[model samples]
Target: MLYFEQLLVNGLMLGAVYALAAVAYTLVYGVVKLVNFAFGELFMLGAFITLSLMAPEISLLGHVVPMPGLSFHAAAPLAIAAVAALGALIDRVAYRPLRNAPRLAPLITSIAVSVLLQSLAQTVWGPGSLRFPDTPLSQIPAVHLGQVSISGSNLVVICAALVAMAGLQCFVRFSSLGRAMRAAAQDTTAACLVGIPVNRIIGLAFVLGSGCAAIAGILYAQAFEFASPTMGFTPGLKALTAAVLGGIGSVPGAAVGGLFLGIAESLCAGFLPNGAVYQDALSFILLVLLLLVRPQGILGKKEMNSHARGSLITAKARKRASMVTAPLRAMDRLFASRFFDSWTFRLLVLACSIAAGLLVQSDYWLSIMIVVLVYGMLASGLNIVVGFAGLLDLGFVAFWAVGSYFTSIVFIDVLQKQFGIDVDSVWWLLYANLILGGALAAVCGAILGYPTLRVRGDYLAIMTLGFGEIIRVVATNWVSLTNGPMGIRGIPSPSLFGYEIGDSRSLYFFALALTVVLLFCIGRVVRSFVGRAWVALREDEDAAQAMGVPGTRYKLLAYACSGFVGGVVGVFYAHFQQYISPASFSLFENILILMLIVLGGLGTMIGPFIGAAIWIVFLQLSLKVPFVNSYPESRYILLGAMLIALMLFRPSGVAAKARLRLVMEGV
Candidate 1:
C-alpha cells in the first residue's frame, strides 16, 4: 500500500511536468491545427537557459547568488519565463511565415526548426550533459503521512502544476484575449469575422505554451538533476502522447491525458519485472491501443477542413507518379548528359580522389569519413520518408539498428556457427542480409503506418517516435537475441570473392561507391511516380486523396521504401564498422540524421549529401579546435545560437532557391 502511494505521488509530480509540456502542444494544435515537432527542443532550451543563468558568475537582480546555493524558488520562474520567450521567438520566426502554407510545409518547417535548434544547442553546450545545482526544495526532508513519503520538491511540483493549470483555465474562460483565442481555435474564419486578431492570438498561444514548457523544464531538472542537449526528447514525446490521448485540441483533455499517462508509465516501471528497461515500450503499447480504440482522441471533435483535405489528395497522386518513374529518368539523363557522358573521365576522377585520400593517411580521419558515408546513406533513406513522403519521422534510426542487428544475427549466428560458413567471406552474406533487412524494416514500417496514417502532422511524428523507443527497448532488453546491452561484436567486414575491403583506403572507395549508387537510386525514385505521390501527400493529403490517390496505400509505400533504405544502410553500417551496438542507434542518431536532411534542404536530391558533408566536417573540425574541444560542455551553446540564426535568416535552407530552380530546369 505504501509503495503504491509513493508511486502515485511520484507519478503525479512527473505528470505535472508532462502536463505543462502537453498544454503547450495542445495550444499550438488548437490554434493552427499543426503539431510543433520542435516543441520538445523548446523545453530543452528552457532548461539549458536556466542552467546557464544559474552558472557561477551570472547575477540575478542586483545581487549575485553563488551557483552552488541557487534555490529552486529563484531559478524555476526565471527559467520558465526565458523558455517562454524563446518559444515565442521560434513562432515569430519559423512558424509564422509558413502558417498560411499547406500543412506539410509548416510541418517541414517545424522539423527544420527543430534540427536547427538542436544543432545550435549542441554547438553551444558541447554535446555533454550538465548538472544543475541541487535546490533547497530537493534538500527538504520528505513528509511521511500514513505510510506515504512525499519529497518537498515533488509536492512543490504537483502544486505548481495544478496552480498553472487552474490559472490557464481561468484566463481562457474569463479573459477577453483568451475567449478570442478560443474562438480562433474553433474556427479561424469565424473568429476573424468578429474582432479577434487571429494571428496575434495565435502568437499569444505560442507564448503561453512556451512559458508552460519552461516551467516543465525547470521542474524536470529539479526531478532529474541533470540536463543534456538531447534531454527534451523523452518528455516531449510523452507530452505529445498525452495531448493525443486526451484529444489534441482540448486543453482539459491534455491535462487529464498527461496525468493518466504518467500514472500508467509509473505503474509499468515500478511494478513490472525488467520494467525500467521496458518503460519506453509501454508508452507505445498504450498509444497503439488508444489510437485503435479512439481515432479522434478522448475529447476531440472531428471537423475536417475542405481546403486542407483537397490539397492532400492532389499531393498524393503526384507523389505516386514520382516514385515509379523518377529513378529511371534520372539515371537515363545522368548517362546521356555531359556531366556523366564520359565514363572514363568519371573513373579517372574517382581514382585520383581515392589516391589523394589515401596519401593523407590518418586512420581516425578515414574512420570519420566512413562515419560520414554511413550517415549520408541514412540521411538519404530518411529523405524518402520525410522529404518525399512528407512525413516527420523522429525514430528513423530504429530501422538502421534493425538492419545492423539482422545482419549480425544472420552472419555471426546462423551462417557462421550453424552452417559452418566462413565468416571472413561475408560479402554474400551482406547482399542477402541487406535484402532481408529491407524487408524486415518495411514490415515494421507497415505496422507503424497502419494506425498512424489516419492522423496527420505532429501526431504522426510523436507516434513514430514512440515506435522507435519501443524498438530500442526491445533491442536493449531482449537478452536472448540482442545479448542485452552487451551488444553484438566481431561482425566481419565485407569481402568480395575473398578480397577483404576492411583496409581504410579500400573501405573508403567501397563506401564512396555505395553512396554514389544509393544517391543515384534515390534520385531516380524521387523523380518517379511514387515519389510524386509522397510529395503530393506531403503538400496536401486530402487534396491528393480527392484526385483518386489512395492515401493509405501511398503512405504505406513510403514507410516500406524508407524502411528499405534504412535497412540497406544498416547492413552496410554493420559490415563497415564490423561491430554492432544498441547505443550507436539511439534517439540522438535519429536527431542527427533528421538534422542532415533538414539543414541540407528537405525534399531535394542533393541537399542531404551537402548536409552530411557539412555536419561531418564541422564535427571533425570541432575536435581539432582547442576552444571547442577544451570546454566540451559549452559547445551546445554555440550550436544553439547558430540554429537560431539559421532559422532567422534562411528558413528554407542553406541552398538558394535559384540553385534549386536551376536543378529543376536541368531535369
Candidate 2:
C-alpha cells in the first residue's frame, strides 16, 4: 500500500512536468498545426542555461559566486526568461517565413532546428552530464501523509506546475492578448481581419510555451539531479504524445494528457515485470491505444476533427486534379525527342564519379563516405514519408533498429546455427542480412501504418513515436533474443557470390553501388504515377480520395518503401559496426535522421545525399577542431547558436528551393 501510494504521488508529479512541456507543443500546434519538433530541444536548452549560470566554476561577472546564494536561485528564473526569448526567436526565424510554404517545409525546418539546438548544446556542454549546484531549495524537507511520503522537490514541482497552468488558463480566458491568441487559433484569417496581430500572437504562444518548458526543465533537473544535452529527446517525445492524447490544440487537454502519460508510465514501471526497463514501451502502448480510440484527444473539440479531415481532402484533390494528364503529355513529347540519347552521357558521368571515389585510397575518407551514403539512404527513405506524404514520423529509427536487429538475429541463429554458415565471413552475412532485413522492415512498416493512417499530422507523428519507443523497449528487455543491453556482436560485412568485401576499398564500392541504386529507385518512384498520388495526398488527403487515389493504400506504400530502405541501411550498419545495441536506435538517432532529411531538403532526390554529406563532414570536423573538441561542451553552444541563426535566416533549409523545383517539376 505504501509503495503504491508513493508511486502514485511520484507519477502525478512527473505527469505535471510532462504537462508543462506538452503545453508548449500544444500552443504551437493550436495556431499553426505544426508539431514543433524542436520544442523538446527548447526545454533542453533551458536546463543547460540553468546549469551554466549555476555552475560554481562559471563566473558571470568575472568573479565566482558562492553556493546557495541569490546567484543559485536566480538561475531558474533567468533560464526561463532565456528560453522564452528563444521560443519567440524560433517563431520569428524558423516558422514565420514558411507560413505559406508546403507543410513539409516547416516540418523539415522544425527538425533542423531540433538538431541544430541539440548539437549546439552538446558542443557547449561537452557531451557529458552536468550536475546542478546544491541549494537550499533542493534541500527542503519531505512531507508525509499516512504511509506515503513526498519529497520537497516533488511537492515544489507539483505546486509550480499547478500555478503555471492556472496562470496560463487565466491569461487565455481573461486577458486581451490571450483572446487574440484564441482568435488566431480558431481561424488565422479571421483573426487577421479583426486586426489581431496574428504573427505576434503566434510568437507570444511560443514564448509562453517556452517559459513553461523552461520552468519544467529546472524542476526536472532538481528531481533527476543530472542534466545532459540529449536529455530532452525522451521527455520531448513524451510531451508531444501527451499533447496529442489530450487534444493537441487545447491548453487544458495538454495538461491532462501529460499527467496521464506520466502516471501511466510510473505505474507500468512499478507493476510489470522488468517494468522499470520497459517503462517507455508501456507509455507508448497507452498512447497508441488512446489515439486509436479517441483520435481527437481527451479534451479536444469535435469541430476540429471535421476541419482537419476536410483540409486533408481538399488539399489532396487540388494537387491530384492539377497534375493528371500533364505528366503523360510531357512523357509523350519527350519520347519523340532525343532524351534517351542523353542517358549515355549520364552513365559516363556516373562511371567517372565511381572511379574517382575508388581511386582515393584513404581508409578514413572511405569510412566517412560510407557513413554519408548510409545516412543518405535513411534520409531519402524518411523523405518519402514526411516530405511527400506529409506525415511527421519521429520514430524512423525504429525501422532502422528493426532492420539491424533482424539481420543480427538471423545471422546469429539461422546462418550459424542451422545452416552451419561461417560467422567469420562478415561479407556474406551482410548481403543476406540486408535482403532479409528489408523484408522484415516492410512488414513492420505495414503493421505500424495500418492503424495510424486514420490519424493525421501531429496525431500520426505521436503514435509512430510511441511505436518506435515500444520497439526500443523490446530490444532492451527481450534478453532471450536481443541479449538485453549487452547488444549483438560479430555482425558481418557485404559479400558478393561468396567474395568478401571486408576491406575498406571493397566496402566503399559496395556502399556506393547500393547508394546509386537506391537513389535511382527513389527518383524513379518520385517520377512515377504513384509518387504523384503521394504528393497529392500530402497536399490534400480528402481531395486525393475523391479523385480515386486510395489515400490509405498510398500511405501504406510510402511506409513500406521507407521501412524497406531503412532496414537495408540497418543491415549495412550492423555489419559495418559488427555490433548493434539499443542505444544506437534511441529517439536521438531518429532526430538525427530527420535532421539530415530536413536540412538537406525533403522531397528532393539529391536532398538527403547532400544533407548527409554536410552532417557527416560537420560531425567529423567538429570532433577534430581544437576549439570545439578541446572544450568538449562548447560544441553544443555552437550547434545551438547555428540552429537559432538558421531558423531565423533559412527556415526553408539549404536545399529547399531545389527540392521544391523537383517536386513541382514532377507535378
Candidate 3:
C-alpha cells in the first residue's frame, strides 16, 4: 500500500508537467489546426535555455563568460520568454506563408522546423546530458508521511503545474485577448470581419502554448536534475497523446487527459512486471484506442468526417497545360506529342541507369547505390499510402521494423531456439520469410488501418506514429524475442541456386531488381480501377464513397500494398547486412522515407526513385565534403531548408510536371 501511494504521488507530479505540455498542444491546435511537430523541440530548447540562465558561467568559442547564475525564479521567466518569442518567430517565418496552402504543407514545414531546432540545439549543447546546478530543491531533504515519502522537487512540480494551469484557465476564460483567440479559433474569416487581429491571435496562441511548454521544460529539468537535447520528444509525444485523449481543443480536456495518462503510466510501471521498459508505449496505446473509440477526444465536441482535399498534381497539371507560359507549355505539348512519349526513350533511360550501376567499380559508390535502391523501395511503398490514398503515415518505418524482426525471428532465433542450429541451412527460408514477412506486415497494416477508418489527416498521422513507436518499444522490451537491444546478429545472407548475394555489387543488383518489381507492381495498381479509386479518395472521401467506391477496401489495400513493399525491402535489408536491431528502425528513418517521396513528387511513379537517388547522392557527397563532414548535424539544417524551399517554390515537387501527362493519359 505504501509503495502504491508513492507511485500515485509520483504520477501526479509527472502528470503536472504533461498537463502543461498538453495544454500547449491543445492551445495551438485549437486555433491553427496544425499539430506543431516542432513543439517537442521547443520544450527541449526551453530546458537548455533555462540551464544556460541558471548556470553561473559558461564557455563560448573557447572563451569563458563570467555571467552570474540566476535563481530558478528569474531564469524560468527568461526561458519561457525566449521560447515564446521563438514560437512567434516560427509562426511568422515557417507557417505564415503556408496558411492558405494544402493540409500537408504546414505539417511538413513543421517537421522541418523540428529538425532544424533539434539540430541547432545539438550544435549549441554538444549532445551531452548536463546536470542542473545544485539548487535548493536538490539540496533539500525528502518529506515522509508514514511509509510514504515525497521530495521537495515533486512538491514544486505539482504546485507549479497547478498554478500555471489555473492562471491559464483564468486568462483564457476572462481576458479580452483570450476571447479574441477563441473567436479566431472558431472562425478566422468571421474574426477578421469582426476586426479581431486574427494573425496576432494566432501568434498569441503559439506564444501562450510555447510559454506553457517552457514551464514544463523547466519543471522537468528541476525534477529530473538533468537536461538534454533529445529529452523533450517522448514527453511531448505523450502530451500530444494526452491532448488527443482529453479532447484536443478543450483546455479542461487536456488537463484531464494528462492526469489520466500520467497515472496510467505510473501504475503500469510500478505494478506490471517489466513495465518500466514499456511505460513509454502505454500513452501511444491509449492514443490509438481513443482515436478508434472517440477521436473528438475526451472533452472535445464531435468532429465531421475527414474530407480528402485534392490530387497533389492537380495544380501542376494546370500549369503544365496552361497557355500562360506559351513557349514552355508548347514545349511540354510537343514532348508529349510522339517521339518523347515512345517506349524507346523510356527504355533508353532505364538502360543508361542500369549501365551506370553495373559499371560503377567503387565499392563505396556501389553501397550508396544499394541504399538508394532500398530507400526508393521504401519511398515507393510510402507513396502508395501518402500520395495515392492521401494518408499521412508517419509510422511507415513500423512496417519495415516488423518485417526485419519477423525475418530475424523466423530464420535466426527460431533456428537457434528450436533446432539448435546457428547457421541457416536452407537458403529458401529467405524467400519464405519475404512472403511470410510481407503477409505479417500486411496484417499489421490492416490492423493499424482498421482502427483509423474514421480518423484522417493529422489525427491519423499521430495514431500511425504511436503504432510505430509501440512496435519499437515492444521490440526493445520483449527481451526473450528481440534479445533486449543487444540486437540479433549472425543472420545469413541470401543465395539463389548457389550464387551468393554477399558482396555490394550483388546486393545492388538484388535491390535494383526488387525496386523494379515493386515499381512495376505500384504502376500497374495506379493505372487500374483501384488506382483511380485511391485518387478519388484522395481528392474527396465522401465523393468517392458516393460514387460506389469502397473507401475502406481501397484504403486497406493501399496500406497492405505499402506494407508488402516495405516488408520486401526489410527482408533484403536484413540479409544484406546479416543483422537486425531496433535502432535500425526509428522515427527519423520514417521521416526520411516520407521526405524522399514528398520531395520527389507524391503520387508520381518515378518521383520516389528520383527523390531517393537525389537524397542518397546528396547525403553521400555532403558527408565527403571537408567543412560539412566536420559538422555532420549541419546537413539536417540543409535538408530542413530544402523542405521549406520545396514547399514555397515547388509544392508539387520537381517531377510533378513530367508525371502530369502520364496521370492524365491514364485517367
For each candidate, the alpha-carbon lDDT, in order, equals: 0.74, 0.77, 0.82
lDDT of 1 at 107: 57
**Per-model TM-score on C-alpha atoms:** 0.82, 0.87, 0.93
As a TM-score, model 1 comes out at: 0.82
Q: After superposition, how far is residue 3 of candidate 2 from its true place, in Å?
A: 2.3
lDDT of 1 at 352: 66
What are the per-residue Cα lDDT tens digits for candidate 1 across 1-667? Answer: 8888788888898888888789888988888887886888888887877786667653332245565434556666777777777777878876776555434456555665666676667756656788866777687788788788888888888888889988997888899988988899888999888878898898899889988887787778877888877888889988988888888888888898889888888888899998877877887778767766776677776552122442321122112234543444554454345554345755775686577667858877887777777787888888788777777788788888889999999988788777998887556767788789978987877777787766655566777877787888899899888877888888998888888888887888888887777767776676678777777777667667889888799888888888888988898888887787788888767876876766666666656766787777876676667766665534444444444444343433443221222122324
Model 2 residue 385 lDDT score: 90
Every model: Cα RMSD to truth: 6.4, 5.7, 3.3
Instruction: Output the number of the TM-score-best candidate.
Output: 3
Superposed model 3: Cα runs more than 4 Å off: 59-66, 139-147, 308-342, 420-425, 659-667
Q: Candidate 2: list runs displaced more than 4 Å.
A: 51-56, 59-73, 303-342, 413-421, 424-430, 621-625, 629-667
**Top lDDT: which candidate number?**
3
Give candidate 1 misplaced runs (Cα > 4 Å).
37-74, 97-145, 189-195, 224-231, 304-368, 415-422, 425-427, 520-529, 622-626, 632-667
Q: How many residue pairs in model 1 have overlapping backbones?
A: 69
Clashing pairs in 3: 246-298
